[model samples]
Target: MSSNSNSNSGRRRPALLVLDLINEIVHPDGKYAADGYFAQARDRSVLERTAEAIARARAADIPVIYVVVGFSADYTEWPAGSPVFEKARADGRLKLGTWATQVHDALAPEPGEPVVAKHRISPFHGTNLELLLRTREIDTLLLTGVSTELVVLTTAQAGHDLDFRVQVLEDATLAGDAEIHAAALKVLSRIATVTTVEGALPSTG
Candidate 1:
């Protein structure tokens, strides 16, 4: 982990946690592209905004951690009855080692940056995310990613419950619709600090 002078004992060391910015959820050719959610997100340029935030985090020497969702080719780990994973399994998307599961080219994880694969919505669930955070002494998470009503919201709430100071980068996340996105941000404001990408950046001045 790179050191940042802005982070001291008085404040928790911050890391940027990007959730589910995978090709399957972001790219137009992805399996879920038929649903048009990814198309809308791309149209709004959420990926570009996320990339900008990532660049700022890197410049500040803050840890950039990626949380992606994927399943095995057989998808045996995916529960049959679960509404979420079941549909994903049926669609045959997010297969491990496939382009769909891979993070988008626009915001790829550089060498040595931790890329954590998650089986569920929360980054902490069934992943080494908590260990990575604790190991790096990261207590403040700058959350950014797709599906504001799903992964971003769930991860922010989970991070808060785990006693980490969480902030959701509003422009860095996208939902299926504007109302859902706005609503998620409003509810998340109660549990986490809701801010823009620039707001999460370290002050260079």
Candidate 2:
């Protein structure tokens, strides 16, 4: 828990981190994806809703940050012998300077918006995200992104450990599988505020 105590502490608005909205689609085989379902698993609806959430956060004067996964062309920066590195080595996806590394058009960040590149499941692990958040004096976070069981879960755990108030936008994130998505949300709902996109909209105040 945060030691912060002040009348305005709880009311300070939360920043928004839209995670992994990049074009790097994973597990296209569907066999390796969640629930083994193809149609909804590949749909971009969740990304779109996350984009709307970012917009709302911006309108509320909250900072909006994006975290994406991408590696240098040769991926020499990936930890030696990592499974993700091995998979990318074979697939050759998310190469920097390639179209696949670009954030999706519908949810791309505008000029001057920060897009932090990460190689691990937790965006803040080796990135400047935590420093940036601290510099901005943000005490809460409105988390939304893909792979609820992966990136989203790792981030929430980190946020809780760092003493930031975290809220997982239920309808604004998706996993590769429906069951995986549901289970992740259930686990996260206990440790953080779990809310629907509409219910968590920025207040007009």
Candidate 3:
């Protein structure tokens, strides 16, 4: 799918949002790896594509904001009735300050980059993501992450509702399987610009 050109006259200020690429979610040894996320990521080379996107954003002087999902050791932030986080709570995974919650090394944030910790699917829900974007005058969001049907889709919708131009880097995201990933991208195309890392960034040449 291709992105529509920006209609606004002013230049668009953009930021790259790397969401839930943490070890517990995307890494091969992650808690959810057995469920097929790792396999899909490996086949798609999601990490490599996302790393390229991050590098492009940095070279273009665009901000790169990292969003990670995790909760306190006591699991207080977790939703008791939510099936999405039930496994995490039961297995005691995704606790803050743990390696499972850290961003994968391949696409790890630079020292001064902003890493926003979230407890829910949508990063903007209880996090300062909006504030950070507003402070930086970023009017566009380039999204890349794991679980295409979950975090990527949710964030795209939320970003659209918040009046930001949202673009999903399809190659940089993974899901349970190829079909699931394609379906999520189809849905996301309705509300966001579904594109590749190369399409989202400028050419280095």
Better of 1 and 3 by lDDT: 3
lDDT per residue, candidate 1, 61-122, as tens digits?
89999989988998866767767676787668788889998999999999999999877777
Q: What's the distance in Å from true for residue 99, model 2?
A: 1.5
Root-mean-square deviation per candidate: 3.5, 3.3, 3.3
Worst 10 residues of 2 by lDDT: 29-38
User: Per model, how many backbone clashes are there?
Assistant: 0, 1, 0
- Please identify which of the two predictions, 2 or 3, would achieve the higher TM-score against the true structure: 3
Residue range with the least summed lDDT across 10 consecutive positions in model 3: 1-10
Worst-scoring 10-residue span by lDDT in model 1: 1-10
> Which structure among the candidates has the greatest TM-score?
3
After superposing all C-alphas onto the true structure, candidate 3 shows an RMSD in angstroms of 3.3
> What would the TM-score be for candidate 1 when compared with the true structure?
0.92
Q: Which one wins by lDDT: 2 or 3? A: 3
Runs in model 2 deviating more than 4 A are 5-10, 26-38, 41-44, 202-205
For all predicted structures, in order, the TM-scores are 0.92, 0.86, 0.95
Taken over the whole model, the C-alpha lDDT of each candidate is 0.84, 0.74, 0.90
The best candidate in terms of lDDT = 3
Model 1 misses residue 143 by how many Å?
0.6
Candidate ranking (lDDT, best to worst): 3, 1, 2
